[model samples]
Target: MHKQRLVIAGSGSTYTMGMMMSLIEEKENFPLKEVVFYDIDEQRQERNAKATEILFKERYPELESFSYTTNKEIAFKDADFVFVQIRTGGLPMREKDEQISLKHGVVGQETCGPGGMAYGLRSIKDMIELVNDIRTYAPHAWILNYTNPAAIVAVALKQEFPDDHRLLNICDMPIAIMISYAKMLNIDVWEIVPEYFGLNHFGWFTKIYDKSGNDHTERLKSRIIDEGFTPEDTEIANDVSWQKTFEQARQMLMDFPEYLPNTYLQYYLYPDQMVEKEDPERTRARQVIEGRQNRVHSLCDGIIEKGTAKDADLHVDIHGVFMVKAAASLAYNLNERFIVITENNGIISNLPEDAMVEVPALLTANGPKPFAIGEIPTFYKGLIEGQYAYEKLVTEAYFENSYQKLVQALTLNRTVISPDKAKAILEDMMEANASYWPELN
Candidate 1:
């Protein structure tokens, strides 16, 4: 059992604390020789780094070194797995992303519509740069990305590093949704075997079979429609916005009962409803800042002030655990099944071969071997093609720095079907993201 050296790329995030906590909890399964925190924002990372140091000292005083750094060479060098979760412009820009989209009567989400396109443009620059550095330094290291607007970032990375199977793109939403499904069925999450397909955040669960090999999809759908749905987690379950999201999931299932749709589909399927529920004065970014961000930072402040993590109240959530599980599946060849983002390559037979699609795959040492989802129906194919085009256009717009391409992408997006509205949102987003995005001419 060779212990791995892990590097968390975006250590400044509120999620880092949970990830560190998760690492400590899962140490026996995915043992580490070292753990390093790497982030560009020194001030933000310092708080998390200091708190993590305290937690590690008391909880994980194990094999070897633990450190945090801003230097890529120091962080990436000799690492076995790099968990990438960088937020390019951070929450302030995310607030702008939401507010800007809302100003134009579109879905104001972090990773959908015009807002996602803005965030996608910013993420490509940083993710590509990070991948290039990983190649230069830890050439053999596996890159597990948990970045938002994953559909766009995945496409961009595939275009640049087509053969880099070590770079795995994953999302936690499907896992979280499954948790809710298990709760509905009164069973453990692992007992449910899910068959899912689509792009990241924009997908659906085609089938869910229990350990007994019994199809529970229709049963779960009836439960959701009858009783509504909520995330099984305490923190997310209590969120007002998330509550509405689940409610919308129920509504979606009632309207289109063939398959259970991902909660995020609400934004595209009913943009007006999503927009109506939002408070333009305080978007999801602001909610995160006030909620999780403040909670984690405050915990850090407490840990630092006491100089001990004995009383630290950091809660490990599925987001962090899922990332570690993905890495472990690769490290130990567990062949664990997960819904991950991978090149379509005919996984969805009707979709473009090059389009990056989300589907269940067995994560092994070689990489994720995606299951074949032979052709889909006309309704799903039409929706997926349109969304895929939007995602591809966003990636192309970033690489070419073409404002026209971005406009085309937004126009194609379901949330903003009007070319004029797309132009309006793009112009606002361009000005808001001027500091982060490449100059689009």
Candidate 2:
């Protein structure tokens, strides 16, 4: 197998260090010839790149070249795989996305309600631009995107590049949740083969089976209901809001026991509860900035100051592990099974074929080969269809610059079902995102 040249598009992200650690762990399977960090923010990416360069020197010195740059052509030229995790407006803009929605008496989340809609609009423009740049710079490179508001971004990209098989949009939330389930079941996460379906964050795990083919879906569901739930990541447990999100998954399961619900569904399934619990003064974005953002950068700063990464404390968690594993599957043709967001195309018999739905897929050299989920029940179908409509409308709204379509999108979102509330939130969002979003007519 030919060695690969990998580029991290959002090298400045807090998750960058973790991703590097994962790459190191999977080096045997996915060998690297070079690594490049690309970001629009020079200072931020430099911080991560400088630290990563030291770590690479100490840990995996086999790499022939390592560099970071703000230039797209320099970062992407001849890359075999591009791992994208860019944040269009950064954490400050995300804070506004949440704060504005909360001020309007609706659920405020990073990727689920009005906040997601706002983030989605801004993300589509940059993501489309990034894709085009990749095509120009490295036409044969596989683009594995981990950008948030992925459902909306996926739909926008699908509409923009329908036949492009090199791009794969994925989320690690399912993997995160499965890690927790593995802990609950007292087994390694890899031992569990899961069957899942739905939109990005708004999905469900229909079944989980051990390698021996023993069904543990009901057993794990019972455990969650009996003992409550929490993510496997200790950092997430430190946040009160994330704790509530995991706990709410138990409640969602009790109310509808058909399948285990994704924790993000808490925003849509119980909007009022989420809204009431949210502190307008401090949202998840603020917590992340105060917590993970600070910790990752501080660690990098320490490594830089010491001029060595011998004592660096960067931990490899689900985010990094999931990304590298997904990339390696494609790079080495490992055919690893992962849950990815891809074009539906009759995967779900009831949903629109063009909708980008999340389902189990075999990550091969060709791209994600999604499993056929046949037909979901009416309850799941209805919820997925409504969310799909919202995603489609958001995509349409961005391309057409139609304020009315955005209003419809938000109105259809479960968190902001009322047109009055959607418009109120939309007006505030429009003002807050004036500099980022396109001028909506």
lDDT of 1: 0.91
Overall local distance difference test of candidate 2:
0.91
Can you write out model 1's per-residue Cα lDDT over 295-345, one digit (the tens) per residue?
Answer: 888999999999998867777788888899889999999999989999988
lDDT per residue for candidate 2 within 1-441, as digits (tens), equals 788999999899999998898888888888899999999999999999999999999889998999999999998899999999999999999999999999989988899899999999999999999999999999999999999899999999999998889999999999989988999999999888999999999999999998899999989988999999987764475677777788899999999999999999988898999899999788889989998999999999999999999888877778888888898899878888999998888999989989899999999888888889999999999999999999999999999999999999988999988999888888889998998899999
Candidate 1, poorest ten consecutive residues by summed lDDT: 226-235
lDDT, residue 272, model 1: 89
Q: What are the runs in model 1 whose C-alpha is more than 4 Å off?
A: none
Q: What is the C-alpha RMSD of each candidate to the true structure, in Å?
A: 1.0, 1.0
